[model samples]
Target chain A: MGNPAFDILSILPFAVACSFGMLILLLEVFQRQTASRSYLAGIAVVGFLLTAFVSGSFLPTGTARATFGGMAWIDGYTQIFTSLFCLAGALTAMIAPRYLQEHGADRGEFYALLLFSVAGMIMMVAAADLVVFFVALEIMSIAVYALAAYTRRSKLSSEAGFKYFVLGAFASAILLYGIALVYGATGTTNLAAIGQAFGGDVARGATGDAAAMSTLAQNAIVAAARGADVSVAAVIGNTGAGAVPLAILGATLILIAFSFKIAAVPFHMWAPDAYTGAPTPVVGFMAAAVKAAGVAALFRVVSVALFSDSFRGGEYGWVQIFFALALLSMVVGNLVALVQGNIKRMLAYSSVAHAGYMLVAFTAVGFRGGDISMGSGLVFYLFAYTIATIGAFGVLSWLGSRGMPCDNFEDLDGVGYRYPWIGLAMSIFMLSAAGIPPAAGFIGKFLVFKSAVAASAAGGPGSGLLIFLVVTGILVSVAGVYYYLRVIVHLYMKKATREVPEMPYGAARWAIVICAVLTLALGVLPGKLVNSSEQAVGQMAGRADGVYQQSAEAPLPTPGGIRLIR
Target chain B: MAETIFFIVFALGALGFSAAVLIAKNPINSAVMLVCSFFCLAGIYVMLSATFMAVIQILVYAGAIMVLFIFVLMLLNIRDDEIEAPRLSIHQGIAILAGTGIFFTIALSIAAWSGSSSRVAHDTMSDTFGTVEPIGDQLITSYVLPFEMAAILLLVGIVGAVVVAKKRF
Candidate 1:
């Protein structure tokens, strides 16, 4: 309402993505029909790189300021995730042209939709309002639904698309309903405003100290009563007489929607079909960028808006739900993945298990235990997982280009000796996915586990829960090894039962090489990434403001204290 | 007293037509019943003082979208033999039970819940709150971003339809 140009740079990533998407659409129309698909993909790559560069610039600043009338937060957390998403988009663009052309669905709309989805992801990471977040989510979901069904000629693809669209639409509706309920309870859609309402007078007092936090338990009820028009006594007694249950119910419903997006078990039934039927490159994009976007959105909501210490003490809580989902996702995703013969389906299930690992970090953050940073570990883990997934799917796409999709394990028999480089790239990706030592996956897991252990040691609420998750996570890693190594064994040990096609030189090959090298580098020298992640998470936590940063907004009460953002 | 009698009659008609929509054997009959249901619902909206919404209910749902539904039905033109006989399964029974349970729970809560009536009272509200001009003003201002985004979404939908349904691209 003030300056039209105020903080316009905050939206650079989204603006870049949107403009590029439209540019690609226009280019498709104006350019010759026979213009190389790779050229179009190259434009997309340039767009992503530009967006990444813009987001990356904010990393050094490490600011957590709100912009767009507080509808978006320009912060280190969003910036880093923005980079992760852009890198995924760039890689997808690099690998997609070949896959789309091979499948006879090469069209300008594919790249356009990819960019649009990427734009949506960018918007999601930056969104600070429920309305904005929901719109961004739909933007991403709709584009992805089309991408999943891009191969209209294939029945399997159409079915996958239809299933994903219907289910995704239902999830969106539920999410919207939850948003409506929360808005009803809190009377605001802005995360900051909601946090302030939840925090009440304690939040406004703005004294940064441990003593202030001791009073938080007592004051929190008063705050909830004031904010939500519910009685403090009723809330403390858990009599279900007020908006507390309604807020929790709303949050839980939203969490259910997020669980569906992250492919947590019980909500992960659609992933196998969608991932298997989608083109190889598009599946990789879904695994990497789409999952990252979902996690980003989930983290923002749970941490910034709905976070409250008292919410956990009640019979109904988000923490318990997260803990249960994490354990189930880990065990079920791994055990069921072990039985899958289709490689894409296996990877899809593997993505679910990976989501479980990130959820462990999410749970720890929600517990607000220890000195461990909140979102950095989750961000790093997603980054590492994205790299490995992209590389793995790149190998599949390479084979797909040669007219052999390698959909099932049998199709990859003896491919190792015949195509050693692709075999080697795929092996690294598998090893990384397995969380083996000296791979990016292991480093990501290490950081995540370290945070969980730290949280447990902090001797706060849910310590035992965090400890149990860490132990189970370690055990699940062993199970992960067997499935991942099985793929490697199929590569080297099994002789060629089917004719191994010659490895072609193209964007997919380059993408695989880049991703493999990046993954290995992340594993071997994770110091920089780890430091950056910690810094980003610390900034998100508001530690940079010399106050404890909990999941809530800056102007709201942290578990330890209140730090005003001025 | 007259308004109350009219309300009960309209509500019953809405419910009956809705049931007919669900229970009709022929697709054309179902479509007609759905139109009747929509009109009855619009009547309820008007009684509730949401005249704009009531008008929109008829214009959009009954007038435009229903035409599209009938056109598709006519285009398909499946023979009576082609339609499968309806059969109730355990799954359907469970779903119906769950739906009814939810409905009762909501109804009971509304009946039982107290102390929020003062908040629900909007007698102090602006006269133009639900009118067309205020809504248009807000849509062009506060909701401008979403409005633009929705436009882009529709454009994407058009592009998607072209790509998905076009025979030769």
Candidate 2:
């Protein structure tokens, strides 16, 4: 009983990652005298790094348990998300001081809000129950909404924050409705309990499903068609091993909400406007931390809980819809980025494209064969994406110095010649993002291709998907090469119209430098990082007897929810 | 009979107060009305056997957070004229149509469609079914960490809010 709630701890890293900011805030608000801002920044960075180290330490132990009457699950999947959230937060915190002091917008509360937001993110990732999840989502979102509009003077920033809040609320409402449907269908809010309920329905088969009682849960109708209790011959609909179709619907709604948060295509309208409009450091956090949580949690919710039962009879719209979105994101993200004159908007599109690439791997999750390798590929891609995105934003922040908002491609003109170190770092970041070798991005994409190919090689029909992904992969990367290079072109070829931004010798630049170095390190040591991710993925999909249940039983959408009254 | 009466009063109260939020066209009035609507929601929560939820609805939301929102509105000194600031015709119309359509559709759909429900026929609160004690039990044990974490998060949020909103910090 060391605390089944340790899953709660698994998600704690993100919050802990932001504690330094809070400490700074406490002094600013309560002490009447605040610590030196630089000192506070140092504390924040150190604290975040420490949190990262601690959370990373939790990865190897594959312990799973139900906490407090099954309200939350602390498991390997939770651990993965916690690690990703903390890593993003720590990196952002490390960079914020320079980012803050530069714009004259960085205040003590900025750091505090950042920490509070991170804490909310941690709780959200670990929320096992729907209510808890909704609460946590709000906690995380409101903090971000504020951060998005942190600069009071910037009309664009305020507008971006307002728009994000409005749309985000709309998305949350959809998600809540979906959650309501799920509760009506299953009569439970706990994910594990939902599984049990579905499992029972499946065990009882078609008769139990159609004949069951519980007017409050009309769609749990699978219950009513038979006798009030059970009969031996009620095994028809249980043809599959699980209640998947309904599960799929619930998962899809979750996907839409998560997609909104992460900024995937079709679902990505808010991102470019938001990113271009928000103050820059907030962009860094949103791009890195918000997207990381979305992808990580998506992988967990879909791949772990639902995958146990779903993926059969082609009902989940799994292969086709995801493939389309992924393809669209990849092609559209790159294409749009190319046309964008605003560097921030360009980066926003690049994120969309990167999300597309990640979605491409996620398609593997929906592909008939539940190949564990694809999970690893997705994780690798995430790590690579995180580093590159952060670095890219860092350089952008550097470009926009002393109340200067970096608005257009022209803003970057002549920076390569003027600020060589920072320019070179940005080049590395852009190249890595474009999947060039000797950069983390290339290794990540390579791993994904290899994994998809490996699964196809194993005599499964993943070959069709493999081919489609490979072709798109090559095509999108080629399409992507130009936009990234365009920045470099602006940096080197164009004349410096403004005074060469005296190489921003600050914490933010150092942060960008560190991330660039790590990108290379990951490229060089792809094996080590890949192995860790592979192991984490293995732990995540948890060996339910080593056999990848060739066909899983899934629940279809109930067509309706619980009939609350008889 | 009591359940029916309670449901009517609370539901009507919620609807009425929420309507006040919308019809007033003033952000401050809307926020205060929202607080009243929240109280109605808490009443509904009580009827649902979610006693603690009702308390939290009132305490965290109506009691604490709404104050922050109103304070911000007052501090910003946003005038009545500024409240309905200029909007792009296309964008503003899109927002209005979308919002109206959604609210109307949801109300219509719920009215037309009778969804499934779980019957908690047993009416009395015992050791379970949402008393302060049960919620307390669950919070400390199952939701213990999240409960604690929520407090800490709120604390951080308070500090952050002061920092961001306060001129000096």
Best by TM-score: 1
Model 2 misplaced stretches (Cα beyond 4 Å): A1-21, A29-36, A58-87, A122-136, A196-250, A311-314, A318-321, A369-372, A450-470, A498-505, A541-566, B1-47, B51-118, B123-128
Error of 2 at A188 (Å): 3.2
lDDT of 1 by residue, A184-260 (tens): 54445665445443343222222222133223234345445445222322222211233343455566678889999
- lDDT at A176, model 1: 91
Q: Candidate 1 chain A, which ten residues in sequence have the lowest lDDT sum? A: A557-566
Name the top lDDT candidate.
1
Q: What TM-score should be assigned to candidate 1?
A: 0.86
Candidate 1 regions exceeding 4 Å error are A1-7, A31-35, A58-60, A196-241, A312-315, A369-372, A401-403, A460-462, A497-505, A541-566, B1-19, B32-59, B88-117
Q: Which candidate is the best by DockQ?
A: 1
Chain B TM-score (each prediction, in order): 0.85, 0.71
Kindly list the per-residue Cα lDDT of model 2 for residues B37-147, writing each as its tens digit. Answer: 999999999888677788889899998999899998888877777767455699889989988986675554333223322223443224455656645644565455557
Every model's TM-score:
0.86, 0.79
